[model samples]
Target: MYSLATGFRIPVLQYGLSPTESLLTKINGGALAAAIAAAALSPPPAAWPFGVVGAGAALLNAAPGPRSIARWGAVGYRRLREHTAPASMTAARGETVTWELYPDHGTMQNPAKRASFHAAVDQALRFVSDQARTAGIQVHVTHHAITGDYTTHTQTVSVHIPKGLVASPARVLETLEDEFAGLGALMRVEPEPIPTVTEQGSGWVALDDDRYASTARITGWPPRDDGTLIRKFLLGDERPPRDAARDVVPERSMAVLYRPLTQRRSRWLTRIQEAANGAFTTDPIEKEKIAIESDGRHDAMVAGEVLVDVDAYITVWGHNPDSVSAARWTMTRLADRHRIRLDWLAGQQHRAHVMTSAHAVSTRKGSVL
Candidate 1:
C-alpha cells in the first residue's frame, strides 16, 4: 500500500512471523533433520547421535511443548512488534485523534492584551483537562507557536486509540466531541490515518499525515533570577504563545516535555556535577566536603542551581516538498528565539509523531471507538 502522507510503500508480510509460527517452524525443521539422520545410520551403535537428536526433537514436539520458549519469545517480541507490525493489522493502529483549540480574538501586542490572551488559553486547557478526567481519559495537551509564510499558534490535545478498543476511528473522535461540547474556544478534531512504513534506522513507523517534524534538546536556559529571559522562553517577549490567535494554527503542533529537578539530592548532585565539569575532575562529593570545611558553606546548601531538562518537538503539515521546507525553516527560527539548542530527530520523526500525539489517554474508553 502507498501512504498518502509520506509517499512511502508499505510492504506485504511486514510482520514476518508470530510466536506460534516461529516455534512450529523450528520444531518441524528439527524433527525432519533428526528423522533423516536416524534413517541414514549404518548400525545400531552408530545411531547414538541420531538418538540424541530424536530426544531433542521429542522435547520440542511433546504435547503442550514449546510453551516455555513461546512465552519468552512473546516477551522479547513485544519490543520489536511496534517496528515490525502493520498499522491495519490492528483495528485503528497508528490512527490519531487531535483537537485543535483556538481563541476567539485577534492579534494583540499590548502587554495587557497579551495577558488576557494567555488567561483565555489557560482556562481552555484547564477545562479540557477537567473534561477528560471526568470521562476517564488522560490526554496530553501541547501548545505551538508557528510563524513565517504560514502562521498558526494554538494548543492541541491529541489521543491515540488502540485497535482492541475501537472498531472505527470516527467513533473515537465522536466520543471526544461529546466530552468537549460547550467549550468556548473554536475547536476541531481530526481523525488522521498514519502511513505505516519501514525506514532504515527507524524500523517500522507511522508517518504523520502530510507532516514533518523536528525535535530540539534544550541545552541551556536563562538563570534563575532572569525573569526576562525566562518569560521570553516560555512566552516569547514580543511573540507570546498565542500572539497569532487570529491566524489559523496550521494542522501543525509542537510539544515541550519539561522535567525539573526539585528534590534536594537531585538538585545538589546536578549542581556539583556542573561545577566539577566546568572546572576540575575532582570528585563532586569531595569538593562539597572541602567547600563546607573551608568556607563553612555547603555546596548542596546553596540555592543557585535550578535545572530543567526540556525536550521540544515541532510538527508541521505540508502537502509538498517546498511547503515542508518552509515549515521546517519557520520552526527553526521560532526555536532560536527562545535560546533552545536543538537536534532534528529526522530518523524517528514518524514514530515520534504518532506516539506523541497523546494516544496514551484513549485506552480509557474501552470499545467506544
Candidate 2:
C-alpha cells in the first residue's frame, strides 16, 4: 500500500495474481524447499543438481519477472484465438446521464472565475458522496474530455446510478443537472445510448471502424500542491503565439472516475492510520512526514470534507493501429513531463475501454484490474 500526500492509502495495483500464476508460484516454492531440506539432511553430489534447478526456478519467479509469464501467456493465447472472432461487450443494466458544461468565456483564465467554478464542482461532488453514504451504494461520476478533430474540444460530465440502489435514479440525475446549472454555465443533457464495443486487441479496443482506442490508468500523481500539477497535465502550456502554427494535437478522450468514501468508513481508516504512523517508523524525517499527513487528514475530517478515491483513464483514438500507437506515445510523453505515471491496460483493454463509457459502474466483486 502507498499513501498519497492527501493521507489516503491505496494499493499500488488493485489486482492480484491469476490462478495460473498462483499455482506456478506454489509449485516453485515447494520444489525449492524440498531440495534445500534434502541437501541439509544428506549431502550428496546428485542433490546439488536438483537444488540448482530449484534455486533457478525461484530466482526466475522473483519480483516482476517470470511469475507473470504464465498469466501473460494464457491471455496471449486467448487473445490470439479471439482474433478470428472479435469479442464484443454491452451494458448489463442501468442508464447514464451525460451533460456538457459550457462555461463563460475566459472562465478558466480568470482566477476568480476559476475558483468559483472549482467550488461548484466540489459542492456537487460532496452531494454525491453524501448520497453514496446514505444509500450504501457506489456512485460513479466520470468527467470526460474529448478532442475529436484536435481543433474543437468538448467536456462532459457523466453520472451513473445503478438500478435498485435508490428509489429514483432519475430524480438523482435531475438534481445533478440543477447543480451544474447553478455554476452559471450552460448544461446540455445529452442522452447517450449504451455503447457496444466491437473488437479488442492486446492494448487497444475498437468502438467502430474509425475509432481504435487504447486506455491507460493514471497510477501515480505528483505531490499535492496548488493544483497546478493537474492543470499543466490535462491542459497543455498556454496558447501558442498568434504567428506560430499550433502543434498537432492527438484525438483522445480522458475520463476520471471519482468515488467518495462514506463518512464512517473514512473516519475509521483515518484513526487506524494515525495510530499506525509513528508506531511503525523510527526515522525522524519519515515520522515528521507521517505526522504532517495525519494532521492534514484530521483537519479535513473535522472541516466536513469528504474523502474520495479517484481513478483516471485516458483513451487515444485513431483510424488505424499505427496512428493509435503514435497518439499513445504522445500521451506518454505528456504524462512523463508532468511526473504522472500511467499503466497501459494490456490484456484487459476491452474492460478498460468499457470503463471510459457512460454506462453503469462495474458491480463485479473482487480485484478491479
Candidate 3:
C-alpha cells in the first residue's frame, strides 16, 4: 500500500488468485503434509519418492513464470470445454444504477479546467459517501471513461447499493443523482442492462459482439508527489503523427472504483497503523518515512478530508485479438513511463472486463476470479 497526500492509499485493491491456482496451492500443501506424515510413519527410503514429488510440485507452483503458465493452461482447457456447450454462458449478477457525467469538452482539454472538474467530482462523491454511511450501507461509486476514436469519450459514474442493505434503494439513488448534478455537468441515467460477455480468452474477452477487450488492474503506483499522478496518467503525451501502418487506436475504457471509510473508522485504523509502525520499525530512514506519512494522514484527517480505498482497471478494445494486444502494449508502455505497474488479467480477463463498466459493482468482498 502507498500513501498519497490526498489521504488515499494506492493499490488498496486486494490480491487474489484464480480458482485453479488456489486449488493447486491447496493440493500442493496437502501433498507436502502427506509426505511428512509418510516419513514419520516409515523410514527415509520408503518416503523419499513421496517427498521428492511433493517438493517438485511445490517448487513448480511457487515460481512465477511456471505458475502463470499453469494458470493460462487451466483457463484454456476451461474455454475449450465451454466452446463445446455454448448455452452455459456466465453472466454477472445483481442490478446497478448508472449516471453519466458529461462535462464540457474543454474540461478534458484544459489542464486547469480538468483539475477543477475532478475536485468537484471528488467533493460530490465524498458527500454521497457520508450519506451512505449514515444510512448504514456501503455504496460503490465507479467512474467509467469510454472512448472509441480516442478523441471523443463518454464518462459515467455508477452507484451500486447492495441488496437488503437499505430499506429503500430508490431513495439512495435520488440523493446521489441530486448531489452529482450539482457539479454543473450534464447528467443522465442509463437504463440499458450491462453488456453480456460472449467469449473469453487468455488475456482478452469478447463483449456482446465484434468488441474484443483486454483488462488490467493497476498494481503499483509512482512515488508520492503532488496529487496529479492520476491526471498525468490519464492524460498521456500528445498523440503522435498517425501512420496507417503503425497506429491502431483501439477503443478503450478506464474505470476507477472508490469505497470510502467513515471518518471514525479511518482515524481508528490510522492510529493503530501508526502505533504498529512506530513500535516495530528499527531502521532510521524507514522510521522517518513512516513518521512523515503518519503526519500527513493526521493533517488530512484534521482538514476533514475523507480517506477512500481506490482500485482502477483499464480495458483496451478492438475487433480482433491482434489489434487489442497492440493497444494493450501501448497502454503498458504509458504506465511504465509513469512508474505505474499493471497486471494484465491473464486468466480472468472476462471478469476484469465486466469490472470496466459502471453497472458492475466494485469487488468489496472476495469473489471467484
Candidate 4:
C-alpha cells in the first residue's frame, strides 16, 4: 500500500481500524487478555488518537523530523512571497500586508493519488480562513509539499499570509510554525512537516447551490456498516454531490461529509438550542437534532461509500446575491434572539461577497447554514 513521491518509502495504510482478525484469533483462543498485555507492552499507538479512520489518517501524516516541517514552510513562503511581495509604493501609502499560515497533514501519502490530497488541502485551507475571518484577519493561503528521501508519497502544507503579515520569510515561518503547532497539538496531530503544498488536480469551484464542480475532495454519508465507510475518505472517483446541479441541494453543504461537527454547525445548533431555552437539549430538542443529521436519502448512498466525521468550510457560488437576503435575515434574527454576535464573511458586502469569521462557520450556501 506504499507509493512514491520524492523517492521515499511511505508506510501506506487505509483508514479505519487495522486488521483485527489476528487479534480476534487470540480472543477465540481465550488468550485475548494476554494479547492486550502484549500490546500494552508494545507501547500506546503513537502520540495521536483519533476515532477509527481519522486516527489512522492522522498517524500517516506524522512528521519524521524538523527538516521536513521546514520544507513545507519554505513552499508556503515561496508562494506567499510571490503572490504578495510588498510594492515599493505600498510603503508610502501607510499600508501593511499580513500573511497567515495553516498547516495540514495526512499519513497515507498517495503518489498516484491526486484527488484526495487536493481535497485535503482545500478543506484545511477553508478551516483556517474560517477561523481567521472570525478573528478579524484578512488572509490568503499558498500551498506546499514536502518529501523524504525514500518516501513515495508527498506531504502537504499550506501557508496563509495576511498579505504582508511579516517582513521576512524567516519571521513568517517562525510565527506560522508557532500557531500551527498549537493547532496540530489541539487536534492531537503532529506539527505540519512544512513543505511545498502542490495541488495535483483541477481544483474545485462551487458552481451553484445545487451543484459544485471541479472539486477535488467531497465527503458523503451512507448509513452502512460495511467498509465502504472508510473507502470514500481514501479512494474514489470523487463524484459530484447529489442535487448539486438541480434547484434543491439534496445534501446539506454545511455538514462536513466524513467528519463530525463540533464547532461550526454544532455551534450554530447550540445557539439555536440556547435561544430556544434548551428546547434542543430536551426531549423535543433531541428529536429536532435527529431530524437534521438524518436529512438524506433513505436508500444506500451508493455502494462502497465511506462516511467519516469532518468539519469543513462550505462555499456556494454563482447564486443571486439579492436572494440571500432571506437567509441573511434568518441568521441575523437568530443571532439577535440568542444574543450571539454572528459576523458576515469578508470579501462580501450587501450579500454580494460574504466570508467567514472566527466565531462562526463560513458557508456559501446561506439557506443550508
Candidate 5:
C-alpha cells in the first residue's frame, strides 16, 4: 500500500521525497484502510462515533477518495522534507557553481606588469569562453577590480559553470587552469570548493574541511567618488594605526562580490534630486548620507556610467579554536575601522571556501554578459 501511495505521490511531488516515509505509508495504509472499512460495516459500539471517525479520516486524507489519507500523508511528508533540506542541497540545485581564480604573483602593482597581467587575464577569459561555448557548456565570467597599493593586489576572477554540461565543479576548474596554461598566463589558479555540511551543531552546521574558519557577511559602505576605503581594504593595505599588543594578523582572505550599475535617465534624476535634498538637510548623519549618494551619483553621471553593488567578506583562519577566536577579533576590528559591518557566516569553517562561495552564491551574483 505504501508503495502504491508513494507511486501516486511521486508523479505529483516536484522536488524530492524520502524513502523512509514512503515505506511507512505503504505499510500503514493497508491496515488503516481495512480498520476504517471494518469499523464502518460492523455494528456500532455504544461508545464509538462512526461519523466522527469517518470525518477524521477524511480530514487526515485531505484529498478526495478512499486512498486520500495515504496520498495526503506523502504530500505532507514531502513538504516537511523540503523545509528541513540541507543548505548545500539547495545551493547545488542550480545550473552553475562559482569558482574563484587567483594568480601566483604577490602584487601586480607595477603599471607595465599590471597591464601585461590584465591582458593575459583577458586573453585567457576569452579563450575559455569560446572553448566552453564550442563544447556547449554555458559560462559567465566576472572581472574583479584589482587595487594598486603597498599590498598584494591578487587577481580575482569569478567563473560560473552550468552543472548540466559539466559533470562536477572540479571539472570546470580544471578546464580554466588548462586554458590559462595554454594562454601562457603563468599564474597558479585555485578553485573554491562547494560548501558542504560536514558536521551538524546545535543551531548551525560546519562547512568545508577546515572546521576553524571565522567568517562574516559584510554590509559595505555606500558608494563614494573616492572609493579608496574599499579599494585599500581589498589591496590588503594594513596602514591603519593599531594596538600592537592587541592587534595581530592571521591567515586571512577577503572577497568583494560586486556588479557595475548602468545609467537610466529616470532613476538617475531621482537620485540626483534626493542628494540635493540631502545636501540641504540640517542633520549631520543625513548630510553624510547625501554626501555618499551625491558622490556616487556624480561619479556615475560622468560620461553616464554605472554604479556597483559590492558585497564584501573577510575570513580569518587559525590552526585551533583559540587561534581562530583571536583572528576573528582582529578581523572584526579592522572591519570596524573601514566603516563596514560584519555578520558572521556562522558555522562556515574555511576562509578560502567562504571567499569563493561569496563569488557565486547569489541571484544574479555575477554579470551574466
Candidate 6:
C-alpha cells in the first residue's frame, strides 16, 4: 500500500499476512518514496564549476587536449568506489551499494575510466547534496568534460562559489585531500590570496551567468568582506599574507597562480623570472595570435580579452587541423615583421604539460597558437 502524501510505497509484506493487513502496515509505507519525491522537485545543484575559461594560466597551458571534465570526475569517483565499497553500511555515507562488490567487479584498476567514473561523480554529488540539504545547506554544481586518455587525466575544478553554503577552496579542498582517508591521489588545493568575487547577493539559480561561471576566483576560506574566518572560523593570526597557496605548493610542480584578469600579467612575469633560473625561456611576445579549443559548452572570449591586454588570442576551433597551427604561426611571423611580439603559445599546451599523468608528453607551444 502506498500513501500519496508520503510516497512511501511499502510493498505489502510478503509471506502469509497476519490476519490481513493491519493498522501497522497502513500507518507506515514508502518512507523512502517521499524523500526521493522531494529531491526530484528540488533544482539540481552545480556539481563543479560551469567551465574553465582558459582565463589566464589555464589559457597558457592545458592543450593537445589533456583529460576531459568527465574524465576528471572518473578519477575522483573511482577512488570513492574503491574506498567505500568494502566498508560496512554504518561507515558508508548514503550509498546503497554492497561495498564488497567494488573489488569483486575488478573495477579498481580503471577508476577514472569513463563509464564508471561519470556515474561515480553523479552519485557522489547526489549524496553530498542530500546530506547537506537535510542539514539546511544548499549547493550548486556543474560538470564539464575535456579530451585526454579519456581515463586517468582530467581535472574537476571551478572558480564559481556555491550559494547558501559558502566554502573556500581550502575547506572544500581539505575535504578533498582527506576524503577517502587520503587513499586516493594526493590532491593539492591552492587558493591565491587575491580579492575575488562570490554569488553572495546573487543567490542560487538553475542556470548561472557567463562571468561568474567561468572559474572559482573567490571562496569562503579568507572569509566574507567583514574580515572574519581568519581567526574565528579559521584559527590563526590576523592579516594573513597573500601567496599562502604559493608557499604551500609542492616543490617544482607546474601550477597556475590563478586570479582575475588584472593579476595575470604580474603572475606570468613572476613565473618567467623564476623559470629563468632553469630552462624554458619566458620572453615577452608582441601582437601574437593564439588558437584556443576549449571543451567548454560555450566558448566565451572573456579570457581572450584578458590575454589581449598583453597578447592576442584568436578563437580558432573549427578550422582544418593541418593549417590551423601553421596559420597561427604565419600571423605571428607577420606581426613580428612589424616589430610586434611573435611568441604564439597555446594555453592548453601548458595545462597538458603540468597535468602529465605518468607520461613524458610533448607539447605544441612553438607551433604559433
**TM-scores, in order shown?**
0.38, 0.70, 0.69, 0.23, 0.45, 0.19
What lDDT tens digits, residue by residue, belong to model 2 across residues 1-369? 122222123221112333344465567667667777877887763566576665545333433522233345554665555432222333335546666666777666677887888788777767776765442333344444445445455666767665666677777778878988866564556546544557766577776545788888777787754645555555566656771233233576666655565667667767766666656678999889888877887888787677666666777777877878887888888887678888895666755665555542433211124
- State the TM-score for model 1: 0.38
lDDT of 1 by residue, 209-265 (tens): 433343332333432332244334434445445754432324455564322233353
- Encode model 6's per-residue lDDT on 1-369: one tens digit a residue: 000111111223211112212332333334334444555687572322222212222222222233223233433454344321121211212211101011113233343443354344333333333322222121211111222233122222222222333344335424433332223333333322222222211111011221111111111121122322211211112334683322221111111111122224423433443333233323334112111122120132232221111111211111233333333343333333333332222222222211211111111111111
Model 3 superposed RMSD (Cα)? 7.2
Off by over 4 Å in 3: 1-95, 132-150, 164-171, 225-232, 239-248, 362-364
- Return the lDDT, model 5, position 43: 53
Give candidate 6 regions above 4 Å deviation: 1-116, 131-154, 158-173, 176-184, 189-369
Tens-digit lDDT string for candidate 3 (1-369): 222221112122112343444565567667667877877887664756676765645443433542334454655565555432122122323335666776666565677876776677666556645654432233433443444455555667777665665567788778777766755564666635445667766678777757888888776777664556665555544455673324334466777666666677667767777777777678999999989878888888887776665667777888887878888887887788778878785556755666666644434422212
Answer with 2 or 4, whichever has the higher lDDT. Answer: 2
Per-residue lDDT tens digits for candidate 5, residues 171-283, read 65676666555333334344454555454332233445655555565544533424246444544455546654355444566665433322353245446556556545789
- Please list the residue runs of candidate 4 whose C-alpha ends up more than 4 Å from where it truly belongs after superposition: 1-155, 161-175, 178-213, 216-232, 235-269, 276-369
Clashing residue pairs in candidate 3 are none
Clashes of 1: 1
What is the lDDT for 281 in model 2?
73
What is the RMSD of candidate 1? Answer: 16.2
Ranking by lDDT: 3, 2, 5, 1, 4, 6
Give me candidate 5's TM-score against the actual structure. Answer: 0.45
- Candidate 3 global TM-score: 0.69
Residue-level error in angstroms, candidate 2, position 345: 1.3
lDDT of each: 0.42, 0.59, 0.60, 0.29, 0.45, 0.24
After superposition, the stretches of candidate 5 with alpha carbons farther than 4 Å from their true spots are 1-155, 159-192, 200-208, 222-246, 265-299, 345-355, 358-369
